[model samples]
Target: MQAKEIPVSKSDLLRADLQESLSHSHIDPAQITTFQRIILTTDGTLTEILEAYLYEKIQLVKLSQEIVASAQEIKALDLNIGTNIMNRKVLLQGKISRRNWIYAESVIVPARLDEIYRERLLKSQEPIGRLWLEHRVETFKEIIDSKRELAGELSDYFLIKSEDKLLSRTYRVFSKGQPIMMITEKFPESYFIDK
Candidate 1:
């Protein structure tokens, strides 16, 4: 007689999918280093985390900021297609070491944000996490994706080879029960290896 097939739960499938995704990116979740795991899973502000880890102040260096009409691909932000969104890119670097620790890109729905928060986001060099803290914005972060990938163009920022692997996580920030922004943060896999 053929063996009966046991049903797989939804959560189990999801867990398997996440593991497969990580494996596809050449990362084994079970074997990931502590620092790498922390960077991948933390919902807290990375600016503060990096500062504490490196024992140096971190700076946010703006790479570019532009207002562009978003496409349908950004359903994660829950914004209508063609809506004007702020596309901001920046690097989180060690102030003393002058080392780029992380690269982040944010797609913000300006209309959903308060004037003060929006203004600071546009004009201040502070990290988004810092701005969230300074403005006292209550936010919920939901990590949507995490993976490892070739650095490609981002290699220039970390001064690493293009083929080097980068560990990254993408998350959506929700405020007032609405998705306000979607951010993707990446760092060189070699940066946070020490115990």
Candidate 2:
């Protein structure tokens, strides 16, 4: 006749059976018994087998949850980098273009001058374009390098620098003379100005 396999269950009955097996065994009292191999023994406690099975299941559940959370975070990051960033990139690329007018605005200038400035600027085309491009590019590079150095120093936190209007907080573009374009942040995009 074949012997029945052990049923895993936690109860007083299982504990008592384990105690009985230990007492009847010929192993010396001084010997240390490893619990792992004990479960496979013919007289192993039902509670031991049950606890091991439950522990394995709990661990698998925890691992699966972590994977799902990570996948969601990656999807969010993809949208931020792809669509949102592309729009910003296109606008910044015109910085070096001489034909492009740097919209002039400041605390001192009236709102009406905006259209007049553009008209005058269109007529001028690139009177001071070279001078504007040179200074702006140098300033741009300085800001980027400074931020990079700061990043190296901090390493723990993000360090980003960009230009923006102090009061209105709008993106202001300028030229060599009357005004200059001040951006809200550091950019890989640049245009032809002076230096």
Candidate 3:
């Protein structure tokens, strides 16, 4: 007799998608490197993780920040199209080694943020996770996607060839049961392999 098929849950499907995305970079999910695995799965503050792993403080270098209207594609932030949002980009680097570790882009709904949080986010170079901690904001991060792609313009920041692969993840942060920010973080696939 044929066995009955079990229904796949949404979380199960997401796991499958993540595995497929990792495989595109030639990574076997079962045999993924430590940092690569962390990058794929961790829903916590990456800046702290980098510091703990590298044994060096991390620096937040703000690249650019601007107020812009949200696009229809920005469904992750749960903002209406044409709503004002803070579009920001930055790099997380090793403070002592001066090595760029990760590049991140964030779309934040300013209206959803408290005045102090908005001010600090726009004016300070603090990592988002750190800001959340300082203000004692309760947050939940849900990873929405993961993939591998060519570095392209990001190659300049990582000092790698444009053809090099980058492992990336996109997630949305929610506070008070509302989506507050959507962020994407990317790092070269070749990094954090040896140690």
Model 2 quality (TM-score): 0.15
Candidate 2 local lDDT, 60-101, one digit each (tens): 000010001121212212222222110111111122231211
- On residues 1-195, what C-alpha lDDT tens digit does candidate 1 reach at each position? 999999965335334545554656666665677777777766888888888888899999999999889876678887778998999999998888899999999999999999999999889989999889999999998877887789999999999999998999888999999999999999998888876
Worst 10 residues of 1 by lDDT: 10-19
In order, candidate lDDTs are: 0.86, 0.24, 0.85
Judging by lDDT, tell me the better candidate of 1 and 3.
1
C-alpha lDDT of candidate 2 relative to the true structure: 0.24
Each prediction's RMSD over C-alphas, in Å, is 6.0, 32.7, 5.3
Give me the overall lDDT of model 3: 0.85
TM-score each candidate.
0.87, 0.15, 0.86
For model 2, state the Cα shift of residue 153 in Å.
23
Q: Write the per-residue lDDT of candidate 3 for residues 74-115, one digit (tens) a residue.
A: 677767789999899999999999999999999899999999
Model 3 weakest lDDT span, ten residues long: 9-18
A best-first ranking of the candidates according to their TM-score comes to 1, 3, 2
| Ranking of models by lDDT | 1, 3, 2
